[model samples]
Target: MFEKVLIANRGEIALRIHRACREMGIHTVAVHSTADADAMHVRLADESVCIGPPSARDSYLNIPAILSAATITGADAIHPGIGFMAENAQFAEMVEEHGFTFIGPTPEHIRIMGDKVTAKRTVQSLGMPCVPGSDGPLDTVEDALATAKRIGYPVLIKAAAGGGGKGMKVALGPEQLREAYQLARGEARGAFGNDQVYMEKYLAKPRHIEIQVLADTHGNAVHFGERDCSVQRRHQKVVEEGPSPALNAEQRAHIGGIAANVVRELGYRGVGTIEFLFEDGQFYFIEMNTRLQVEHTVTEMITGIDLVREQIRVAAGAPLGYGQDAIRFQGHSIECRINAEHPDTFMPSPGRIDGYHAPGGLGVRVDSALYDGYRIPPHYDSLIAKLVVHGASRNECLMRLRRALEEFVIGGVETSLPLHRRIISEPDFINGSYDIHWLEHLLGLKG
Candidate 1:
């Protein structure tokens, strides 16, 4: 086991890793920007290092500063908690070259899965299903048009290195293809510095489902199960739940088995997520997240597994002591990503929280680092907390989620609490009949 691990990120996720390390008797080194000197994780970590100034490029993404911090603190491993440098393949290689464990998948796997087009090809070669589209990135408008025509109308142009809905555009017909392709490439260049884009058939009402898998160096791999993340806006997940109301036990087992087998075959290590788009009882591989997902709380709630602890143990060369049969799926679980933003307008709301109170009860958990006077830095993500709830049944989980949302209160800045409350009360959400476009449609963002 590592004596100390440096967390190379910020916000609640950094705190999440810190708590996990603390429970395992591992000290933590929290790296933060100047703006986050007073962050909660920094305060609780055994040691804290100021990596750089407020901008993420200078601080959270500053690889040399982070490596220096780990060296100075004598950290045996570094945990890149979601976003920033979490899925950077070069960063993973650098960590290993510097003689510290990167507590995630191997750099080889990260590199293969970081690019969407390459990931799709690799997984499809492994016999996984994929949406019909171009074999690789389109080199020009003519190439995009050819691929789009082959895939039929309403093709989705996506960036090879894109995420969070950036570098994505949809064209309903040939008339719209040129503009959409150029726009997607432009966005891709701006966001990822790589204008390479690919094409895929756009499913109008697919549900976003992802399977969580964990593997070890001992050739053991197991999947916890799937998360229903269909509730989204602008390609970002909002509400996530386990035991998707759309899938049955057989369907869940089938997908979970496929995910585990893929990891085992790829020699993948630590935690990863295989995301898919489900429609008409078929699953199409969308992309894979090579790091711990923000919605991992819902999977943990349903499976009763400490994923962070498992991730660390795997990085430390510990074998998964069990297999798929030993793993058991329990009750339904739901997680609402409460961002520091307006519910209606959906604008960033960063400021000092005047008053804060988290909901407490059976089956309810709040993962947040916010306090009354802790000023939320405007430079970082707006996600302030995660409200996860579990129950014996989906119905009961819905009821519990409602009560928990009502109890949550944060003053001096707006939040998405009201939006979550409204979503829970909607017929589509309550019945679990909502699709990826449900939330946008409900908000009148889509026609």
Candidate 2:
């Protein structure tokens, strides 16, 4: 086991890693910007270092500053708690070159899976089904047009290097292809420094299902199961649950096996997520997240497996302690990402937290870094916490989630709590009949 691990991110996830490290008897080093000197993770870590100013470029995203902190603190490993440099292949390589373990997948896997186009090709070659689209990047408008004609109308133009729903556009037909192409290219270039785009058949109202896989250096890989993350806005996940109500036991086993196989084939280490778009009983590979996901908590709740501990153990050259059959998936778990934003407008709400109290009781867990007097800075994501609940069943889980949300309270800043309450009470949501477009449509009705 590593003597010390440096966490290279901020917010609740940083705290999440800290708690995990503490439980494993590993010392933690928290690297923070000036804006987060008093952040919860900073306060909880065994040691702390100020990286840079408030701006991400000079702070959280600054590679040199983070490496310096880890080196000076004698951190043998660095755990990137999602976002920032979590999926950066270059950053992972840099960490390894500096004689520090990057507690995630290998840099080779990250590089291969970081590009959407390359990821699709690799998965397809590995016998996983992929959406019908261009064989590779569409170098010309004619290539896109031809591919669209073959795949049928309503195709999506997605950036080869895109993420977080950026650098993407949907074209209903040839008339809209040109505009979508140009816009996606510009956005992709500006955001990822790569304008290359690819086309694929866009399924209407497909559910976003992702399988969580864990592999160790000893050549053992297994999957915990799938997470239903269809409840999203602007392509960002909000509400996530496990053992998707949409899939049966057979379907779950099939997809989970495929995800596990992919990890094994790649000789991947640590935790990763293989995302797919499911429609009409068919699963099409979308992309792979080469690092731990925000919804990993839901998977942990159902499996009773500490994913973070497993991640650390694997990085320390340990074999997986359990096999696929030994893993048990019990009950249903749900997580609601609570962000400091206007309930209706969804604008960022960054200010002092006057009154704060997280809900408690059975199966309720609040992963947050908020306190009564802490002021939220506008320099980063507005997400303040994650309220995760588990129950014996999906229905029970939803009910518990509702009660937890009602019990939770935060003052001096608007939160999405009211919106969440309204969502959980909706008939469609209650029945688990919602898809990716469900939340947007619900928001439109309110508008």
Cα lDDT listed for each candidate: 0.95, 0.93
Where model 1 places Cα greater than 4 Å from the true spot, the runs are none
Residue 402, candidate 2: Cα error in Å is: 0.9
Backbone clashes in model 1 = 0
Residues 299-330 of candidate 1 have per-residue lDDT tens digits of: 99988899999999999999999889988989
lDDT of 1 at 339: 95
Worst 10 residues of 1 by lDDT: 145-154
TM-score of decoy 1: 0.99
Residue 285 lDDT in candidate 1 = 97
